[model samples]
Target: MQANQSRKTGVLLVNLGTPDSPEVPDVRKYLREFLMDERVIDIPFPNRWALVNLIIAPFRAPKSAKVYKELWEERGSPLKFYGEDIEKMLQAHLGDRYFVKLAMRYQNPGIPEGLAAFQKAGLSKIVVVPFFPQYASATTGSVYQKVMDVVSGWQTIPEITFTNTFFDHPKFVEHFATAARKYIAERPYDYFLFSYHGVPERQIRKGDVSGHTCQFGACCETLRADNRLCYRAQCFETTRLLARELGLKEGTYSTAFQSRLGKDPWIQPYTEDMVKKLAAEGKKNVLAFSPAFVADCLETTIEVGEEYKEVFEANGGSHWQLVESLNNSPLYVELLADLIHQRES
Candidate 1:
């Protein structure tokens, strides 16, 4: 292969995905595809299939569809809309040197379509940037695997590179801090909550190359070489970096995980529990941040913003405000552009 003899490179930006519509059937189809992934459920094929088809998809789809309805804007899913905007902004920022395309890992504009654009552009090098800020087997890992599966059959495969994680990137931290500052100046918050998406404890332990090191204690307190790919550790590291940037003190802020499924144990101090605890402790006002999500999706907008707010108020808290996700923000677009340039250089 002659490397396509082109100076251009391809940037494929992938996000978790959204249902094409809020209808039950569409949500069910999306859930079936998403929950069936082995990396996500982390179970045997038969068990995973049974869980998705027989139990989860059938039961959760209608309820999840309602939530998606609440999240949908006039232009449709905020996740998809912001993703498209970010792709366009990033393309403009990178200019003629890069061909940028966006994809949703599960639904419309999937991995195959994104890679096909790169192939059509005759670009010899492709960069796969999973939208996940933290490296997780279920999210970023799955995206990388799907990208390879799509490109493996090509006669002349491009030089594909993957970004495993960028949780502690300075610009990423700065963007969140700046967003939080905008809210802080407007109102007084008694505490700050950093809520990240939850995964099973087993998932974290499974990714531990250094066996038995990812125990729920000091093991994940710092970002060490052994725990480099541990998702929980990276989430905590993100919280720490953002807290420092926002000039937050130790007791003033806390970290929690959200959106857990199944009966299995998930990474803790769960978000729901944290909200109740804060209310019980007489913390009347709190500012919540979901740094794990770059776009304002169901999790950030409905889960933390609406559902959690209700929980806090019902439990006796007066105010619960969620700091918005970095949805197509200028800083966020610049951050993505910087990452692309670094990878290309």
Candidate 2:
């Protein structure tokens, strides 16, 4: 049945979640849920369970907890804080015509609660936007599946539209470019590094509908129908757009992937490796960008901003700058609003 005309449309913004607290238990819980997802681990159930429970969770949680503590803010997680801010800003921009809700794919302010709010409001249509800019099975795919799983339990579900990815969206690119310009205007940099969160090479291969489509190398250098849904390709496309916007010259900018886990080969060159290479090459003044994340979190704030910065400095680099993310920026809000409007129209 169609929704009642009197009810407003609903907008749900979903992001990769964070632990409820920086404590060990909370971090463990979050990691268990996040790593256990089939889309994420991409292994058979028996193997995946053993890997997450018997190995990764037990060993990784405590160390991860420490990192979370380091990344935690006075207001709690910067990721969750930005999600809330974006929700509020989008709601204000959209006014009362729509019900805007934010949810984390894994933790508190979850999909169920967000969906329930829309259900309570008797929304006509629901637009679910995964905060991932690129379509990766581990991120956007998992979010979509979780959203569907939640809605499946409801007796009545609204017409739901999912925005899979917006990697090349002009406004989305503009938001990052604007943020980058603010940094560039303040200082000069010898090189720009676009570092995206890495996924397994197998994951990239899995995304290819045609088996032979993803061969790495020049395969991901350009975006085409064959590799449109390929996360690595989309990431490169994002870097290209931002480079164009910033007027970065050839060889001045490079792309690398970060936050690789376990021993399996993930997309490369790894961000850490890139940092050392830049340092050795005498690219002392470096500007780094993590466009994989729209909001600053442990990965962006600690890993890239702090960890990678240390790596650069230790390897003979004098200056290492991380361009801040588009957290609750007006341009970012506008981009979200525009996405919602486009879906509604």
Candidate 3:
């Protein structure tokens, strides 16, 4: 624990982590922590472990280390810095009534370190908010588990509560849509693409809400019941809602998935394939949005910003504009403030 000022209510901001450093060894450590999670891998332990250590870690580390180097600035990982900035901004907005600290689920400055900071602050009540906007077993559930792992050992545990999901929060969509419009004003773009992280179809079935959900195209029929926990349907619904808010036509935009890990089939319309399709169809200009992530990370920064950009350019497309992520922008800060206030109310 870093002070011991009693009466502070702690707010821990959790995000997916990054490498401890831009070097290959550190990147490998981060990858191991991230890929080793059963939720992330979603396979029998033996198979997942063998696949990761043998194939992914052996070949991908050096390449990923270079990518990490590109992302690292004077302050280090953008995920860390952005998470910290949001926490600090949210703390100021919430006033001294709370102590805010950022924690990564994997790698350096993890839950242990963040909890220690809060413990030192002498906070007895805590509210944990995972950075994932959508509730997926892999990301949100992982945070939920690790947080419990930390708080379980505490002799003086706070009244801890975990926010399950905020995908449908009005302020969340409003803030994201505002950013989208602001960036593409007067820009000539034919389509808006909302790309969310992908999980296998089987994982979707695992979280199926009774027999009626995870029905994909059919799930939209029961939007009210699924809520935020319906990862597959909600990704489409988020796109639908935001498209409506922006006064866009039905065919003006599309939603797809990115970041599939293995051979097992993930949710369809993969982003990489989607990019090629757009380019092949002679679509010259497109704008992409990744609202599933409130802050930019590897998925948003590299996959959407660069790799997909390469896809469009390679396919003879003229323009590919990525709508910047929310990060610590004013509207996003306001959205967080509203979330906290909503919780209070």
Q: Between which residue pairs do clashes occur in model 2?
A: none
lDDT by residue (1-345, candidate 1, tens digit) is: 112344478888999999999999999999999999889999999999998999999999999999999888999999999999998888878877778889999999899988887797788789989999998899999998898888888999978888777777788898888888988998888899999999999998888877878888787789888888888888888989998888899999998999999899999989999999999999998999999999999999999999999999999999888888889899888878778778868
TM-score of each candidate structure, all chains considered together? 0.97, 0.96, 0.93
Query: What range of 10 consecutive residues in model 2 has the weakest lDDT sum?
Result: 1-10
The weakest ten consecutive residues by lDDT in model 1 span 1-10
Across 1-345, the per-residue lDDT of candidate 3 in tens digits comes to 233354367778888888889999999888888999998887899998998899898789999998888888898888888877887788778776677788889986788888887776767677888888888899999999998888899888867877766777787778777877876786878888899999988888888758555666766534566544778777887888788888888777898999887677889889999999999988888889998887787888888998999999999888887777778877667766666555655
Measured by TM-score, the strongest candidate is 1
Which wins on TM-score, candidate 1 or candidate 2? Answer: 1
Please list the C-alpha lDDT of all candidates, in the order they appear. 0.89, 0.89, 0.81
Query: Candidate 1 versus the native: TM-score?
Result: 0.97
User: In model 3, where is the ten-residue run with the lowest total lDDT?
Assistant: 1-10
Tens-place lDDT per residue, model 2, 240-266, is 999999999999999999988889999
Query: What would you estimate as the lDDT of candidate 1?
Result: 0.89
